[model samples]
Target: MSSLELCYPQLLNWSCRGLECLHSEAVLLYTLFSSIAVITVALNLLVIISISHFRHLQTPPNLLLLALAISDLLVGLLVMPVESMRIIESCWLLGDIMCSLSFFLSFTLTSASVGIIVLISIDRIVAINYPLQYINVCVCRVCVCVCVCWGCSFLYNGLILKDNFSLRDRHCNGECIVVNNYVSEAVDIVVTFIGPCSVIIVLYTRVFTVVVSQTHSMNSHITAGTGCKVKATKSQRKAAGILGIVILVYLFTFCPYYYPSLAGENNLQVLGIVTWLLYLNSCLNQLMYVFLYPWFKKAIKFIATLKILEQNSSHANML
Candidate 1:
């Protein structure tokens, strides 16, 4: 091999080759990836602030959203930049420990984001199907669910990637790729994608059906006592519809990323495109909220203008 082929001259053939990109193409790639990272962080940060600072926005559904925002924020702030450098440079300059930790965080945040979506689906289901009991169940139980989602994500990814931390069999100098055994890959696909997506689809289908039936029923005259119930149900339906869009976008982006695992092909070239698409989902989510929810727009205005800094601003009626 030529001297330039090796990422580390000392490692010879074992070291991965350095990437060679045309100068113009390299500049474009950096610009694209950097823009994505910035947008992801900024948008998710708006969500985090919107939910955390506003008392009216701290409802159970929004609490789940906050957790999701945090995960996405980490994806932007941590995973995207590192993964971009690793992919574009085509070599790992960082040591093995950093590589392992980066992969661990990527997997954990991804799983947590999916878990949060599942929780949101469940929350919407309960709000629609059991509107009367939603208040009782959501107030404390939903918080517990959010906590469990994050905790499980961390522990589960740790187990799945433990070997990468301890063994160097699949890696060499200047190589940051992670290798997973068949069983582990299968389990990850099932747990992170298959099972959660199935649940979300099923729940959303039911939610849509119920919403349509409810909308049809709304045409009929309603008694005064039932007016409050009707209003709440309408609000719940709207939230469900918006969340459904988010889920659809998420699945669209993530399914491609997992295709290699499903097809039993594990190669870097296949991963690079799909993984960036998956990261793009983070930016899309906030855009969806902006388009679908007026409250988010109002919140953004207040945040941008520093109106939220005022005393008692948390109590401002956002909804």
Candidate 2:
């Protein structure tokens, strides 16, 4: 028996169960998880394609957005499908090899997504607090930072791949479970939760402070008839607001999942729900960009308009 069987013996109870009883419960949970995962994947793919195909949406900050979208898209397309299939099969039929691969890929992408968000918060902080400096630094620094995030997350996940595959249970599903080792648990907490959350808190704190300071400065300048200062202040506040929302979404979607997993509980039902919500975060990113950022909305609209015009021109040529 594996650690899960030791913890939750009821899951494998051979005495008080029928096939119907097991099938009904499994189907209900599978439907709920699979539907949500599929929708989340679809939405993330849409966001990735939209951003990738549109040159107008390819700024430095939006480059971070593209990275995030791609990471989440992988989680949806690769990780969630395996998870959903596991839920339906009621066992990890893919055996140990695919299990380790899936678990490592899922955790790496999830960590990288969080890291990218932290980088975005830092970028906004710099942009708001040091506008002239930001313009001078150029896109090369952004690329380097993104590459660092990817490399760090990849290495972190690679370190734990052995523990991920060491489980003795063939019935364990494809979802990421905490390894039964102190070092692995500690690393998971630091890499997946603590480090990212620390970055978020620090960067957002500085960002809010800068925004407040700029707002006050702009108000004073406005009193002296400086229109540019007012515009600058408004832009700073808008960026700050968007960052705040991103932080909230990250906390709400991710913390619940990591918190319980780190606690070493084997509550599969709770784990399933938290995992689904975390996947939903990928879909929510697009919605956040559409609702919070005016530039994103305008760029999307512009792309739509151009697409329409191109279609019309093609129709005219055919005629």
Question: What is the TM-score of candidate 1?
Answer: 0.93
Point to the candidate with the largest lDDT.
1
Query: Which residue ranges in model 1 land beyond 4 Å of their true spot?
Result: 1-3, 220-233
Model 1 lDDT per residue over 1-319, tens place: 1134678878787777666766787788889999999999999999999999998998888888888889999999999999888877866888899999999999999999999988889888888888778867755777788889989999999999998988864666888878678899889999999999999999999999988788777757567778876886688678777878888898899999989878867677788989999988888988888889788999999999999989999999888
Score candidate 2 by lDDT. Answer: 0.72
Worst ten-residue run, lDDT, model 2?
A: 12-21
* TM-score (all chains, Cα) for each model: 0.93, 0.81
Model 2 steric clash pairs: none
Backbone clash pairs for candidate 1 read none
The deviation in Å at residue 281 for candidate 2 is 1.6
Deviation (Å) of 28 in candidate 1: 0.8
N/CA/C clash count, model 2: 0
